[model samples]
Target: MDTLTLKIIFMIGLISSSAIRLPHQQQNKQNTVTDDRKTPLETGLLLLVFFGMLALPLLYVFSPWLNFANYKLPLWANGLGVVSFAIALWLFWRSHQDLGENWSPTLQVRDGHTLITNGIYQSIRHPMYTSIFLWCIAQALLLPNWIAGFAGIIAFSIMYVIRIGNEEQMMMDQFGEEYQTYMQQTKRLIPYIF
Candidate 1:
């Protein structure tokens, strides 16, 4: 297939995978508390990353002027992107399923949140972050434009660096020794090797 066709397919898969989480998110929102630990800076960073990764890519795909469409990689990279996207979507779906109503978009704990340690969470403390990292890698591989391709990674990295410590702290506070044991047993974003 042509590069453009592959790019389109990857974008569709990425968007569809993200879209599927909306209902689950909304369902869990009702249980979220007002005590969000995500600071304004973190929220701003997240919004910036979201805009760069999602909106900018779509804009570049449609207009092609917002981003410099240079640095085309090998066709095999696109194939790798497809596989990465598939894994990302699957992991994302499973993570959400495992979290169930315990999931929240931000740093707020749900009313009846329980520590989930099964499915994708069995080995990774942050499988959703892993899935997002996969998305970033896939985005970088699939899109030819420099800004559109690499923005996801740059943005996600910033968000991860800023939020991960706080997230773990919150989990540790809530789950106490149970979370400590889980942390000792699992990696943050990757399994077994991270």
Candidate 2:
């Protein structure tokens, strides 16, 4: 198949996969209780990050009719994209496994939960966010076309910057000394090497 055809097929697969909600860490606990403090502005911006970062690139791919004159990438660029995406997917799966029932779109403490210290959580306090960052980076590397990659990176970065502080403060308040200890032990997005 030609390049455009491959892009179209990839776009369809990407959108289909992302449409469904996936599971997270801590299988035995209930993870759905939500705090009610998110403002409409926060929710709206987050939705943009989630969907726009994910969907827009596929839209550009499948519907070249809507393409905004993207830069052409060399074959090597596509290879870089694949590798980045592979690493990102690995991190995401690890994060989900670590989170189990503790995972939710919005921040909420799970019922009868302990601070997770195993797996990816051992290296970074927020593997989920790290996954997100790497995912965006992968998109940027893969697309190399600038618009899709940069869009995903900037959108996700903004969302995390806005969301993380609030979430961290809330966790600290809830877990107190335990959370502080964890904070001291783990970096936010990178491992001890960082």
Highest TM-score: which candidate? 1
What's the TM for model 1?
Answer: 0.94
Q: Candidate 1: worst 10 consecutive residues by lDDT?
A: 64-73
- Tens-digit lDDT track for model 1 on 35-109? 577679878987978886788778767775854466767878888988898899899988888999888878888
- Tens digits of per-residue lDDT, candidate 2, 1-194, equal 24564365335435433532243323433444544446686787788886657677766665564455566667776666666666666777777767666666665665655678888898799887876777676666555445665788889888888888888887887789999998999999889854
Q: Rate the local accuracy (lDDT) of all candidates.
A: 0.84, 0.67
**Best prediction by lDDT:** 1
**In every candidate, how many clashes are there?**
0, 8
Segments in model 2 whose C-alpha atoms lie over 4 Å from true places: 5-21, 24-34
**How far is 137's C-alpha from truth in model 2 (Å)?**
1.7
Q: Which residue runs does candidate 1 get wrong by more than 4 Å?
A: none
The local lDDT score (0 to 100) that residue 5 gets in candidate 1 is: 84
Clashing pairs in 2: 24-100, 25-99, 25-100, 25-101, 26-99, 26-100, 26-101, 81-142
